[model samples]
Target: MADSNDSQPGAPVPCAACRGTGQVISNLGGSPSQVPCPWCEGSGTQIPGHDAQAARRAAAA
Candidate 1:
Protein backbone atom coordinates (compact mmCIF):
# COMPACT_ATOMS: atom_id res chain seq x y z
CA MET A 1 0.00 0.00 0.00
CA ALA A 2 1.13 3.52 -0.65
CA ASP A 3 2.07 5.62 2.34
CA SER A 4 -0.57 8.09 3.38
CA ASN A 5 -0.03 11.90 3.54
CA ASP A 6 1.99 11.82 0.36
CA SER A 7 1.57 15.11 -1.48
CA GLN A 8 -0.81 14.90 -4.42
CA PRO A 9 -0.21 17.26 -7.28
CA GLY A 10 -2.49 20.35 -7.32
CA ALA A 11 -3.62 19.73 -3.77
CA PRO A 12 -3.10 22.51 -1.20
CA VAL A 13 -0.96 21.44 1.73
CA PRO A 14 -2.00 22.02 5.29
CA CYS A 15 -1.05 25.13 7.19
CA ALA A 16 1.65 24.54 9.79
CA ALA A 17 0.59 27.37 12.09
CA CYS A 18 -3.18 26.70 12.11
CA ARG A 19 -2.69 22.94 11.79
CA GLY A 20 -4.79 23.07 8.58
CA THR A 21 -7.73 24.50 10.45
CA GLY A 22 -7.29 27.83 8.68
CA GLN A 23 -8.27 29.85 11.70
CA VAL A 24 -6.70 31.04 14.92
CA ILE A 25 -8.08 32.42 18.18
CA SER A 26 -9.03 36.07 18.23
CA ASN A 27 -8.98 38.34 21.25
CA LEU A 28 -11.84 40.59 20.20
CA GLY A 29 -14.41 38.09 18.95
CA GLY A 30 -13.37 35.25 21.20
CA SER A 31 -13.55 33.19 18.08
CA PRO A 32 -11.32 31.95 15.30
CA SER A 33 -9.60 34.20 12.78
CA GLN A 34 -7.64 33.88 9.60
CA VAL A 35 -4.12 35.05 10.15
CA PRO A 36 -2.02 36.27 7.27
CA CYS A 37 0.52 33.64 6.31
CA PRO A 38 4.08 34.74 6.88
CA TRP A 39 5.45 32.32 4.37
CA CYS A 40 3.44 32.80 1.19
CA GLU A 41 2.18 36.18 2.27
CA GLY A 42 -1.19 34.62 3.23
CA SER A 43 -1.35 32.61 0.04
CA GLY A 44 -1.08 29.46 2.16
CA THR A 45 2.10 28.22 0.55
CA GLN A 46 5.53 27.68 2.01
CA ILE A 47 7.55 30.64 0.81
CA PRO A 48 11.20 31.28 1.43
CA GLY A 49 11.94 33.98 4.01
CA HIS A 50 15.39 34.47 2.61
CA ASP A 51 16.82 37.43 0.77
CA ALA A 52 15.17 39.66 -1.85
CA GLN A 53 15.76 36.87 -4.36
CA ALA A 54 12.87 34.86 -2.95
CA ALA A 55 10.66 37.91 -2.68
CA ARG A 56 11.43 38.97 -6.20
CA ARG A 57 10.69 35.50 -7.51
CA ALA A 58 7.38 35.51 -5.70
CA ALA A 59 6.52 38.93 -7.02
CA ALA A 60 7.42 37.98 -10.56
CA ALA A 61 5.09 35.04 -10.37
Candidate 2:
Protein backbone atom coordinates (compact mmCIF):
# COMPACT_ATOMS: atom_id res chain seq x y z
CA MET A 1 0.00 0.00 0.00
CA ALA A 2 1.19 3.47 -0.81
CA ASP A 3 0.62 6.35 1.56
CA SER A 4 -0.87 9.56 0.17
CA ASN A 5 1.61 11.51 2.25
CA ASP A 6 4.44 9.96 0.28
CA SER A 7 5.75 12.13 -2.49
CA GLN A 8 7.23 11.03 -5.78
CA PRO A 9 10.94 10.49 -5.71
CA GLY A 10 12.91 13.73 -6.33
CA ALA A 11 9.79 15.87 -6.03
CA PRO A 12 10.17 18.97 -3.98
CA VAL A 13 8.16 18.86 -0.78
CA PRO A 14 7.10 21.94 1.09
CA CYS A 15 9.40 22.55 4.02
CA ALA A 16 8.04 21.50 7.38
CA ALA A 17 9.81 24.36 9.10
CA CYS A 18 8.58 27.17 6.84
CA ARG A 19 5.35 25.59 5.62
CA GLY A 20 6.51 26.43 2.05
CA THR A 21 6.92 30.11 2.80
CA GLY A 22 10.72 29.79 2.91
CA GLN A 23 10.70 31.91 6.03
CA VAL A 24 10.17 31.60 9.75
CA ILE A 25 9.23 34.04 12.48
CA SER A 26 11.85 34.81 15.03
CA ASN A 27 10.70 36.41 18.25
CA LEU A 28 14.12 37.42 19.40
CA GLY A 29 14.33 40.34 21.84
CA GLY A 30 10.52 40.36 22.02
CA SER A 31 10.14 41.40 18.39
CA PRO A 32 8.76 39.19 15.68
CA SER A 33 10.92 39.17 12.59
CA GLN A 34 10.97 37.11 9.45
CA VAL A 35 14.05 35.05 8.77
CA PRO A 36 14.98 32.51 6.16
CA CYS A 37 14.00 29.00 7.25
CA PRO A 38 16.99 27.15 8.56
CA TRP A 39 15.55 23.76 7.71
CA CYS A 40 15.06 24.54 4.04
CA GLU A 41 17.78 27.15 3.86
CA GLY A 42 15.14 29.52 2.40
CA SER A 43 14.33 27.13 -0.43
CA GLY A 44 10.91 26.23 1.02
CA THR A 45 11.56 22.57 0.30
CA GLN A 46 12.40 19.72 2.61
CA ILE A 47 15.88 18.32 2.47
CA PRO A 48 16.39 14.63 3.06
CA GLY A 49 17.59 13.93 6.62
CA HIS A 50 16.98 17.53 7.63
CA ASP A 51 15.67 17.79 11.16
CA ALA A 52 12.68 20.13 11.40
CA GLN A 53 12.68 20.25 15.19
CA ALA A 54 16.32 21.26 15.33
CA ALA A 55 15.72 23.97 12.79
CA ARG A 56 12.73 25.21 14.76
CA ARG A 57 14.84 25.41 17.90
CA ALA A 58 17.58 27.28 16.05
CA ALA A 59 15.07 29.68 14.55
CA ALA A 60 13.60 30.36 17.99
CA ALA A 61 16.99 31.02 19.46
Evaluated against the true structure, the overall lDDT of model 2 is: 0.86
lDDT of 2 at 19: 98
Cα lDDT of model 1 by residue, 1-61, tens digit? 8687787776676656555554444454686666554344455444334243565477669
| Model 2: pairs clashing at backbone N, Cα or C within 3 Å | none
Which parts of model 2 have CA positions greater than 4 angstroms off?
Answer: 1-6, 51-61
For each candidate in the order shown, give its overall lDDT on alpha carbons: 0.54, 0.86
Clashing pairs in 1: none
Per-residue lDDT over 7-46 for candidate 2, one digit per residue giving the tens place of the 0 to 100 score: 6778888998789999999897899999888889899988
23: Cα error in model 1, Å: 0.9
